[model samples]
Target: MTRAKSGKSGKSGKSSRKSSISEKPSITADSSTAAKPSITSKSSSDKPWPYAAGYDNTPEVLEPAPLTVKGTIPPWLEGALYRSGPGYEIQKGGRVSYRSRYTSNDLRERYKKAEAITGVTFCQRDPCKTAFQKFFTTFKMAAFGGPKMGGTDTNVAVIPTINFPGLMDDPDYKKKKGKAGPRNLVMTTDGNALQELDPITLEPLRLFSYGAIDDSLNASNLAPAHPCVDPDTNEYFTVLLTFGPTALYKVVRIRQSIKGPEYEPDLDVLAEITSPRPTYMHSFCMTKRYVVVCHWQCDFAASGVSVLWYGNAWESFKSHDPNVKASFYVVDRHQGRHVATFEADPYYAFHTINSFDDDGDIVLDIAAYKDHTVIGDYYIENLRNETGGKPPQQAMLRRYRLRNIAEQAALSYGKKGQPQPVPAQIDFQLDESVNFELPSINPSRYLRNYRYAYGVNRSGMNKTLIYDRIIKVDLDKIKSGAKHSSSATFWMEDQCTPSEPVFVPTPNSTEEDDGVLLSIVLDGRRRTGFMLILDAKTMKEIARAEMPEGTVAPHNFHGVYVPNSVAA
Candidate 1:
């Protein structure tokens, strides 16, 4: 991955307007050995201004000790909250821009065609000249890229030549041989391995991989950040995208036996299916009977050679195809066979709420968007503080119903010869809303029909991408023609952004919403971070765990909560 540090001047690059920072006394571990730190420019105003503009540069591995709680910690809520994202920012030499290298030749051809079309020398006019100059300069620099000074590091170990056996033959790999090490570090989006942290102290404990922890399991593949756990069997399931002789999507299941005299856990591959193409996918859906791997229209290069030359996964994605149907590869959980391939209208989804088997018909709920514009809007440069452009279209809670066509075809069309298995038909269900994403459901209700769903909600009319409210949706009421679908909402104060809300179900709870929603909120204006706990039923604040002063928490993507008994 080509990591570059651009625009480190701490300016928004807009007007010369600066936001004032209020001074506060900083907290230190020991006063004897260290001086009393104050919230100075170094601690507050460094990096990008207007904290929500982008991520901060404080990428240290500090163990924040003695967190202060505003309210009492619930006795039943005893577990670790494991959160993961990009943590460290380190500057290294011999960096190469993958985007420039992959697109340089194509860009030159386009430029020459444009010149001939207009019958004018490039950069000879006013507007056209300016546009031509910009395009040429961008491509030229990309073709002859130089080393970047600063970049974020996740502290993940590079696999060297072990993961990619053909790295020696690749031309780009030859250039990066000794000049730079293999860029196999786990990233926020493309997480290669899972890092376990101390739940209470938020201290890094260890890294996890299929090959490292279990000798029986041998697979070198990237682990998706979001994985689903089966409520019935208590088995954890995730898909690993493998590339080599043939691109294979492997479904892995992790089972644990807690009742035996000696506790034992097993990891096994449930299914291995060939993927049609290589694309950047963050999450998938798993129902009670099957696992649905949706091949979203977000396409990377179709071949392994293109993927290797392209370098980064993000650059590999060329464009989003609106006409191509999103392909869903359904695999039976028990049999581990490719049951059917369902096609639906093209759309992109980052998170799925839940999936269930509704009377033999598969129903899946996800946060869907029309295109991939929302992703580019997440870049630090395009943030509201920098560009001040309108926020990307919000993702809505869209329900898709996949009807079993095989049964319908057998009855309607009749069996002429060997009856062909019908493809599952998909259609939209329920009215859409534009205020939801980063969805969460009660873990106990997973793989089964449930009533409620919780997620981060954006404040109405706010022009930024930060989520300012947490909302609870009554799925039953929404389906029944209720005018208002939201049952409750907990809106944070202005300038405070909330992370993905995690639902923790109460022990022996009967009601669906009998739980708590845990989220880490950053007060961009105050330069402080806190853990907000809310009542899942009413969306009311229960407690707030505030970190020590001078502690900066970077934005996190996903998190999981493990009960005390389970952690033990």
Candidate 2:
């Protein structure tokens, strides 16, 4: 199956269940109105700036506390929404509980000490004041221990403990099996460490390693922040990177259920690729039959060892090279081998919206930027600046069609028998108005063709906070050469910024868009946060669970919603 066919309206895929949001008006405020819309407020003489207050040193809710509901929450919505931006909200038994905590509290304190900054970090100060210091720091960092970077800052993505062996050891965790079976959870960052959190309390248990799953993966110190899970097979796929004279990349797979020794998982090395220069990849793409690893133009300097000397990953990257095209390494899952390589224009992307096999071709959709400047856009100083920072940069949605990749891969071994670059054509590009990022889709539609995609809208200009709106787009319209008229919808409120929208489908639903969207919104005016629930089909507000007075939910990167049935 490929992208949905043309002539189908975006709303045609909605669930047959009646929507409570039908009577509510969709939020389509004009630019002027949306910018300065007034919100109810309690007067205060010293209110901190909204963006700064929400992002910097926000308070944490150590205990579960009930929140005030503004409207009716769907009784069918039973789960805890956890965000790596450091918080979670649970709705169960006609009550809602919100909690927030810092996963890297100790790590943050260690950096504050002047002489303790010995490990490589992402964007912290180098700490190497002189050439002699740089030499000693590099020697100490690369000596014996694993990649000493991002200490326990597993604030990126959330994965279920059921995906890995030996993680669900808690008898309580194992006994409380949901429809999918009993499981705990873990949070991950760019480093090798995974912080396991109690699914019920949201308390981090301990720091673990990828090596715990299999000894072969012990050499890897870096892995993709976003790992892929095949919905059909329940297999987990992640790429492990070991930096050395030659950077080595190994694509590994882990089975859903365990059947052997506690420590020994059904893990296997699917493919391996060695490169002289390693590129920084935040995420990758996967379909039912293939796993695609993208090597963009951004590469680490001095074969990645520079991170040791520079004291962080961000300081060691070489600038984007315009002449070098990006490479896509396609691994055939059934055959367990690297089958093809495709080339595309030099561009940087942080997330893959979705992917699927279309006939003989592979269709991959991603949010792309012209260069890597988007990385720097997240600096604390930049994010705190309301109007002085650089012009807001937006990521546009781009679709690539790798035509008959297996056949093209086979031809590479003919005659000269040397691999050549196979061209990957741009099948579609969304208009600039969308400015999409932090994309999400119906969980059931993952690794399969579906019409709707939900994400944040960052097209607003000169604003301190990013992503002022949430959006829903019809992928079928974009594929049918309707870049200008792609069916897109938005939900917005004045003085509120939203995190990524998570789509939770109705149980056993047939329609692709039959679900509700969940997002945590920081209310600028109130200086507090709330859980904003929207109708996935109409992009209209269904209900909201507001945090207690003076409670500010910190800005987060990614999140996951585990239904009570999965694991309470």
Candidate 3:
């Protein structure tokens, strides 16, 4: 993000011109080549700028960070600016060496400016650094996206979730209940990992129980996949909820009127879409009239396993026909009807829906082929059909755009320019380890209409290239589709695995900054989590609140941005 003309930019510009930019390198000439200078510094007709680039030792500063609320930065936050090296990258995870203290006080004004956008009320919360709650489930599939919900006021609703149990034979008189953080619920198979507690107070929301879906679960064929929310009608929905290897395929519609602060039970199943085989649907977004689901066609590596279902490969699977046309599903959430199924050719234009990053940007999962594993080389069709491509050896991020992809695919089929995709400027950065994972994105466009994106870097190293920085993208940029841009900024502290950051732009009133964001950071070795406050415009780290002792699930399925008035 570039600085505005008024403050930071102007000051930085003048300081840069006056300063002697280059630092005489404390260099030990490795060879005689350096001893014998090739020519002179004036070789070029125009001498390099006096401040030509070099390691300045001085902190490369962005505008002074906007101020955070007085209580925003917690004591647990490790300061920024560390000496790069050793004690940095540890086994369980990297150890934070340096940290940044609260410096810039302008955040208050910046935040106040941002607050001008929203017409809502919210609490000035000092978020806690812990997974407020955790639920275990038995479903074995590719991934668990953060949860989705809708409604407002004291009356709200959510798709409470938990990890699916494993081979453990623990049953209850009834079903155990837990709420996912939208995309909550991790199937760890370890009983101890489940946190059956109240999200708000961290008390026991319910007892974590496990058992068969039912005596008739085998015949019932159900799986609680993507539970969604309808804001317009204040209803919650999901595909069929089944038991056993909890990986369900057939799509059945379920819904209920969201009850405000009441003991309301889950909604009822209203419709069904029987597929030829199990077609896994990952994250779901929405349009004015329909829900957009990332339709995944694959034979799960852990399908029927009592132990490893949905835990296997996601990069390559082959269908009966390598190419019949694969695409995304725009289904009607109200009536459960398929509005339009659109597919993009892999060879042409395409973007696998990625999740959100720290700055509220999209962290796209690039190609069908993952390079990290044995099955890495396979492309999307091969991953779907089973036989194709070579694994790149672990997952790698692929850069793509919707417009370029749609146009490419259109031309491949002899159709062009009819209607090209105006993608938000969401580009994928190439990393060596872990193919970029998709993040959860909120569809609401306050103004420019940014495509919210998220991603988690599984690389163990703390390097910014390999990771050490969590990314967030906007839809406006995604639609703008800049092939390469630095706008998709990052949010990360030393050695912390950010589950997924939630963007909460403060409302218009007696506020402070351009916008403020809240996020959870799951620190690996520390066995804890923390809440982070960030500057929306610059994507700079603002403040942090450390979570209590506990290894919260390393990641989250999803999270929500709750406004104030109803937070009670």
Q: Each candidate: what lDDT?
A: 0.50, 0.64, 0.30
The candidate that achieves the highest lDDT relative to the unseen native structure = 2
How do the predictions measure up, each by TM-score? Answer: 0.66, 0.83, 0.45
Error of 2 at 563 (Å): 0.9
Clashing pairs in 2: 85-556, 177-182
Candidate 2 deviant stretches above 4 angstroms: 1-48, 112-118, 126-182, 256-263, 412-418, 483-486
- Candidate 1 residues lying further than 4 Å off, grouped into runs, are 1-54, 59-64, 71-73, 85-223, 244-246, 256-268, 384-387, 405-433, 484-490
Clash count for each candidate, listed in order shown? 0, 2, 113
**What tens digits encode model 3's per-residue C-alpha lDDT throughout 1-568?**
1110100111212110000010011110112211311212221344321111111111222222221132444223222211110001001122221111111122223323554211111111110111111111212121231122111001011122321211121122012222212111221111111222122212122221111212221233223323444444434433432223434322333222144222222333333333333433323434333444444343333342312322322322333344533344444445554433445432211124433222322233443432122222222222112122222233334443222332333343433312222333324444354334434333243111234544544444442122245565544553465533343566656646564444454454222224555555545445454556666656787655453454231233344443212211
Q: What ranges in model 3 sit over 4 Å off?
A: 1-136, 140-226, 241-271, 301-327, 334-336, 344-467, 492-496, 509-514, 522-530, 547-557, 561-564
**lDDT digits (tens) for residues 1-568 of candidate 1:** 1111111111112211111111010111122322432222222335434345224423223322335567655667754444443111111221100000011122223434554212111122221211112111121111112232111112221110111110112234234332232211111223334422212222222333444435433344444556666756756677776655566777777664354212334566776767556555667889878887766766656543344454334444557776777777766787765656667778887778888888878888888888765555554333434335445567877787767733533353433432233444544343344368878889888889998888877765444455667778787776777655444455566767777788998889999999888877776666667778888888888877665555554455555554435411
Better of 1 and 3 by lDDT: 1
Question: What is the per-residue lDDT of model 2 for residues 380-447, given as tens digits with 9 covering 90 to 100?
Answer: 55555554655446888888888997687577543452256689989877888887888999988888
RMSD score of candidate 2 (Å): 11.0
